[model samples]
Target: DTAVSQTPKYLVTQMGNDKSIKCEQNLGHDTMYWYKQDSKKFLKIMFSYNNKELIINETVPNRFSPKSPDKAHLNLHINSLELGDSAVYFCASSPGGAGYNEQFFGPGTRLTVL
Candidate 1:
């Protein structure tokens, strides 16, 4: 079984549209994260959740939201998407807390905004 999985592996939309991507992990990990990979291939952490509680948020815009229904699932919602938001979004999970364990990432969801 996949340790981590994301729905709608690809997303294409206009600049003003709204979209959401869903992620789930079966690894029984306590910490999960949302990362964005930009065109220059720079990976940055957008949000982190531990056991359904928000932990780290890296100054992300209010238009972006991360929700964790439980430890196994974290979802990302983007409203009024912008061109700058076009990037590969990755869902990851780790056994312990942030920076303490190896993270297993899902095959990313590529978002393209026109």
Candidate 2:
């Protein structure tokens, strides 16, 4: 049983292609999020969702879109992937309480664009 899981742990593709990264958590948390970690290891929040509601972070690109089928799942879809998009995508979750809650992260999905 995986607490958090993402498909294609390592994704290598050419520029301009489209790809989707799937994420799921079984922790029964009310909120889930997507984060991007660059080569410098700076973790940045991309999107947050609770039952399909969008809560995006301003730093994220317009090419990136997040979809949540339910409280336990959130997927990322990218359009016209670029070389700059190469990074590690992490799925995380929290209990959805007041204030900032601690997040549990997935193993990560590394995307490489050539």
Give TM-scores for every candidate, taking all chains together and pairing residue i with residue i: 0.98, 0.93
Alpha-carbon lDDT, every model: 0.96, 0.88
* lDDT per residue as tens, model 2, 1-114: 989899979999999999999999999888888889999999888888876687655577789988888888899999999999999999988888426888888999999999
Record all residue pairs in model 2 with backbone atoms less than 3 Å apart, i.e. clashing. Answer: none
Candidate 1 per-residue lDDT over residues 2-112, each given as its tens digit: 999998899999999999999999999999999999999999999999999998999999999999988999999999999999999999999997666999999999999
Q: Return the top candidate by lDDT.
A: 1
Q: Each model's RMSD to truth, in Å?
A: 0.6, 1.3
Model 2, runs deviating above 4 Å:
none
Best by TM-score: 1
Q: Which stretches of candidate 1 lie over 4 Å from their true place?
A: none
TM-score of predicted structure 2: 0.93
